[model samples]
Target chain A: MYFENFASLVDMGGHGIYVWPTYALGLLVILYNIVSPMMARKKIVTQIRRQAKAANNRKKPASSDTGRKVNSHEQFSANGQQQASTTESSRTVNEGE
Target chain B: MNWTFFHKLGSPKWFYEISGKWLPWLAILAALMMATGLTWGLLFTPPDYLQGNSYRIIFLHVPTAFLASAIYVSMAIAGAVTLIWRIKLADMALKCMAPIGTSFCFLALLTGAIWGKPTWGTWWVWDARLTSMLILLFLYFGVIALRGAIRSATTQARACAILTLVGVVNIPIIKFSVQWWNTLHQGSTLKLTEKPSMAPEMLWPLLISIAAFYLFFTVVLIIRLRTEILDRERRTKWVRNAVEAGARS
Candidate 1:
């Protein structure tokens, strides 16, 4: 569909030297735009899944290596969540008037 | 306060979700316009009486050239949005738009050169239009390079936003350079306030081709923006839900 005949498309009114390369480069760049992002999204999903798997593995009682290193950011988030629940509990106790 | 709309706009997941619905329609319109444009330009239009069929390259050249300038304007506007509103989506839009702009600029230069050879008997000249258009390409490259060079997303966004704003001054100069100087490249074929210089038979296809390229640019930008949103929001809860849902189906 791209070219009627390889020779004709290339020859392009005898402007092949310029014409063909322009189209070729355009197609290549467009393909890169389409392909690169999908690849990056796939990589991100894989990394997240890997981390989730690690977290799940750590939760298992049989996994004796429970001391597996946790990411600092993840640890911080967990701590923040606990602190939030503790504050809620304190508020509930105060409200038990 | 229209908080629901505001919140939805802020949420990358919402954008990714909504854009998913919109992409197909954009793609279809872009494809249809492009196909019609290409067909009309390549086949329906009469060959140039002077330059012969080599002039057909105008279909590709003009659209890409227009987009080259248009993309910069869009990117600069996106940069402004990020700077004023601190919208992460705008920053991502700017980032996603860079390579697309660069490619369009490259095509414009390449096609212009090709159109040049058959018509002007040279591959390139240091015409003002040509030189500034080249500069536009370099500016796009610089933005893309700056994004990769910086490690922090916020810093990268700030730096690139400023750089894009600074480069915007070149766009008008590029557009007017032909008329201001006795450039080898001719003046604009189409303009807003004046009648088209070309015959309707030729003008019709040229118009369609321009529309097609515009649509194509939209299709590509939306795709790139969606990808950028996903990458930036990867660690967010909504992203996790979106990805897991995608993985499942």
Candidate 2:
């Protein structure tokens, strides 16, 4: 609003080149900060969900949490696809909601 | 003074659930404040008589620089907590904050170089302020690389804590660099004990941007911390349930 016209706003009396790029870079940094973590969360959830599915397919799916079998989660996750007789490798890696 | 919060603070699950609730609000506030500050600084604020429009870079440059230093200090405090109390959450914080801190430090240095060109007629100078800031960037890198290099989780945590504590010495040097030795970088515009040497309109946006950047950092740090907590605590049943029940945090 300080500028008289749009041209002057962009031109900034000849400093636009510097000002604009700095802002564009700022925008990129902000987006990266948001996107990176979201992706990580998605990946983690998908892996866990797959492990749960594998455990269910293999046996009576450890019906409980705290009193559940130790190393069950890791046992399924590490060899989830390898032991999966039905070829879980191609199973949709769904990140549960 | 009630001290029960310290124990709660050390609980990763408590932090994960709590931060999840706060993330949305903080993200919205940070976005709003950042947009307001940048727009005001870019358009509404008058051009400086001396530096012309190039001074506007200060909007991002100064805020990122402030955060780079503040994040390092926060990392050091987290490091100290990890060392003294052996808090797993503090160690997680120290680990998660490294990437965010490094990004901001890189931004600050890049923006500073850009701002330097038009005003100082050079991209960089081997002065105290610039050199010290560069060292701070390297310190961030050192901690991050050290974390990746060590295979054992406990050893990695301790090594990073000691490194962060040692590198904390550079923060004060960065603070006093502009004054201790005459440097190309200008002295601080906003000071605690002195009136800001800036026009009211310009100062307002800069201050708002500083607050926005801090909020933005917290928003990002919490998200990162939550991911870290999930990764480390995956074996626990609570983490398993939380990951399955919750959507992308």
Candidate 3:
């Protein structure tokens, strides 16, 4: 609104180079702040589920995958929550909140 | 007054649940405020006569610099709580706040440097304010590094807390550095005791932007804290129930 046109807005009377980059960097930092935590949460949630599943499997004496086999089996099932659909869980799996 | 509030705050489960309820609202408010303030400051407000268009960088620089110092002061308080009361939450807060604080501090320094090139005709100087701010950044790094050095969790918490409190001494020096010695940096634009030097149009957006940054920080902090609670309390019944139920849903 202050500037006469798009070119003037971008040019900003010759200070646009300095002004724009600072804001771009600010936006990058803000995006990082919001994103990194979500990524960490996903990693931790998946890890906890995998560990819980492995513990449950061990409690079953009749289970074929025992001792060394269980560890390898768990390693195979990285998407360990197979029964839980990915899309739904990804949306709602943040600690039932 | 009852101290039940304090005890409740100390409980991670209570904190996790309460924070979850507040997160969405805080996030929405932060988003709305940020959009309004930034757009107004960027387009509608008149440019400064002396500084021209470059003065717009103040919208980004000032809020982050404010957050940088405020977060450090907060960490020091959290450290003190950890030391005196031995509260686990306090220590966890100390741990979590470091990265966020560091990011904002880094942004402040970077933006300051960029603003400086045009304003001061140099990238940096050995001036008191700049040097003290640089020290604050290192202090943040020191707290984070000290955590990784110790193997024992308790020891790690205590060491980081002590480091944070010790580094708090830099805060006052940073505040007074402008007055204490001649510095290239100008005086504060806004002050609590006195009226702001800026015009109403510019000042309004800057104030809103500052509020937006604080809210945004809170939203991110709660998100990190909740995940931390889940990680630390994985063995507990509440966390297990929540995670399993969440997965089922």
Most lDDT-accurate candidate: 2
The whole-model C-alpha lDDT of candidate 3 against the native structure comes to 0.82
lDDT of 1 at B23: 78
The C-alpha TM-scores of every prediction are: 0.82, 0.89, 0.88
Badly placed stretches (over 4 Å) of model 3 are A62-97, B247-249
- The candidates score, on chain A by TM-score, as follows 0.56, 0.62, 0.62
The parts of candidate 2 lying over 4 Å away from their true place are A61-97, B1-3
- lDDT string for model 3 (B225-247, tens) is 88877766665567667787773
lDDT of 2 by residue, B153-249 (tens): 6678789999999999999999999999988888888899999999998999999999999999999999889887776666566877887786578
Candidate 1, DockQ to 2 decimals?
0.17
Lowest lDDT sum, 10 consecutive residues, model 3 chain B, at B240-249
Q: How far off is residue A1 in model 2, in Å?
A: 1.1
Which pairs of residues collide in model 2? none
Residues B1-249, model 1: lDDT tens digits: 774675347555667777788778888887788778867776567667788768778888898899999999999998997787666677788988888889889989988887788789998999999999999999999999988887666678889999999999999999999999999999988988999888888888788888877887777787777766654554456655776676421
State residue B161's C-alpha deviation in candidate 2, in Å.
0.7
